[model samples]
Target: MMRARTRKLIGTVALIIFLGVYAWVAAVIGAGRISLAPAWAQFAYFLAAGLLWVLPAGLLIRWMQRAD
Candidate 1:
């Protein structure tokens, strides 16, 4: 029980940090490159960037919920 709780706490903190960093990086790249692209390309890039974090986050959430 303690292990699971610990995992959840760590994972939550890690997820928050990961999301913050990821959003910063994505914004940087988008401003640097995607901003200059065509409208459709910029839209595509933003769409992909927006959803890309879900995969890793989902995995982390699964790991956090797993039994010890």
Candidate 2:
């Protein structure tokens, strides 16, 4: 079992990596596929993608807080 501090550090690192990849993918998809959508649809997709990173982050945070 990891110490709380260690868990937090690992979680933070994981979160950073996850966010970087997530943003890159989102940007690529937004630039490629999303660019083909109508303006309103593109707006909606961008909005959804913007908020989508939070769910996995929340899960990671929850795990980081778990009792050892």
Candidate 3:
């Protein structure tokens, strides 16, 4: 099993990479399709996209903080 420090370091890097890719994808999709959508639809899409990363990140963080 990995040590706590190793887990945190790995998790931190993973989270950074995950968020960067997620944001890029979200921006691309938002610009390509969501921009043409109605205001409400755009709002909904952006809102959901904005918050959707938390779940996976939260789980990763929990894992990172888990006892070794």
Candidate 4:
């Protein structure tokens, strides 16, 4: 069984890396593709992209909390 502390540390690191990569990709997309989108579409796209990260993060948190 994995230790709680280890899981936490690993989860934290993974989350940080994931967020960094996700943000970079989002930024690149925003700069390249989203810039040409209409105002309302840009708003919706950014809003969806911003919130989508939470889904995977939630799963990661749940996994990190497991006692096993």
Best by TM-score: 3
lDDT of 1 by residue, 1-68 (tens): 55999999999999999999999999999999788899999999999999999999999999999998
lDDT, model 2: 0.96
Over 4 Å off, model 2:
none
The lowest-lDDT stretch of 10 consecutive residues in candidate 4 is 25-34
Can you give the TM-score per candidate against the true fold?
Answer: 0.93, 0.90, 0.97, 0.92
lDDT of 2 at 51: 100
Off by over 4 Å in 3: none
Which 10-residue span in candidate 1 carries the lowest summed lDDT? 1-10
Tens digit of per-residue lDDT, candidate 3, span 22-65? 99999999999899999999999999999999999999999999
For model 4, how does the per-residue alpha-carbon lDDT over 1-68 read when each residue is reduced to its tens digit? 88988999999999999999999999899899799999998999899999999999999999999986
Misplaced by over 4 Å in model 1 are: none
Global lDDT of model 4: 0.95
Clashing residue pairs in candidate 4 (N, C-alpha, C atoms within 3 angstroms): none
Error of 1 at 57 (Å): 0.4
Clashes of 3: 0
Regarding lDDT, does 2 or 3 come out ahead?
3
For model 1 the local lDDT of residue 46 reads 95
